[model samples]
Target: MTTPSGDPTDHEHWRRPADLEPGQPAPRPAAPAAPETPGYQGPPPTTPATTGWRPPTVVNPMAPRQLPSQDQDSIDADERGARTLTYGIAMVGGAVLVIVICLLCSRVLF
Candidate 1:
């Protein structure tokens, strides 16, 4: 893709192949060849101890993310407001439905 001014750029056009139909699945990728282990080739060891076992240490990929206090406050406020609005709508709808039913009953009884 290039800018409207017709300048040449690095981007290449990506689209469906001309030969393939729209609904057909894309061609499957060739499966990767299995890796070979060298030197010690015997029946695989049954247990970790057989292969000189060592306890593995866990490492976190990334530190825990925390929003700033202001952001957290804003998010909390938004959540509260949404909950309040939902509850208010439900209450009003229920009240209106009950009033309509009561009025109908009064007209029928009188």
Candidate 2:
């Protein structure tokens, strides 16, 4: 069968499985034919223009300002307090969870 473009190979005849007899083998669709026209070849590459080496210039001339000093002892104490608070909260949460589980088990059993 010819397609709308008038290409004969584009719509080669192939019988459906239902159309064949019970013992008859099914036919494969024909492979597409190669194009008559040559494949596309894009524009050729060109080398880029180059510039000579240039000396680097300093953007800022002023000396960098110093950061404020931190009190190591105070920082250590704050870290210790945060760690203790985290552990206390975790313990309280675990105890509440255990109490809830025990209550649920007692209710189910009784």
Candidate 3:
């Protein structure tokens, strides 16, 4: 049998399995001699289809980023100020309660 087209070695038109050596360049994929179509019987079309079949690529859409609201900074500042005022008031109340307790204890002992 004649060797297939594009094959480098024409020796005996065929190579035994053991005859091939290692590190041989990969053989190119042979173009299909016939194109498959459903229910069509005729001489394969004269014009080759310009484009080949391609699988649809999956595109990862980027998520939209969220920016801070216009009032965020002002709201944070107001909350911090309110916390500071509440802490100051609590400290003053605790000091007054301690002084009152000390006076009552002294009076009871005397």
What ranking emerges by lDDT with the best candidate at the front? Answer: 2, 1, 3
What lDDT tens digits, residue by residue, belong to model 3 across residues 6-108? 7576564545456456767656679878966688587876975558757677997889999866898998999999999999999999999999999999999
Worst 10 residues of 2 by lDDT: 8-17
Question: What TM-score quantifies how close candidate 3 is to the native fold?
Answer: 0.37
Global lDDT scores for all candidate models: 0.83, 0.84, 0.81
Instruction: Give one digit per residue, the lDDT tens place, for model 2 in 31-70.
Output: 9998799777787888765686566786858898899999
Instruction: Quote each prediction's TM-score.
Output: 0.35, 0.50, 0.37
Q: Model 1 shows how many backbone clashes?
A: 0
| lDDT of candidate model 1 versus the reference | 0.83
lDDT tens digits by residue: candidate 1, 1-110: 54545445733345677788999998988999989868777898685455666677697488779975568788999999999999999999999999999999999999
* Residue pair clashes in candidate 3: none
lDDT of 1 at 25: 91
Worst 10 residues of 3 by lDDT: 10-19
- Which stretches of model 2 miss by more than 4 angstroms? 1-58
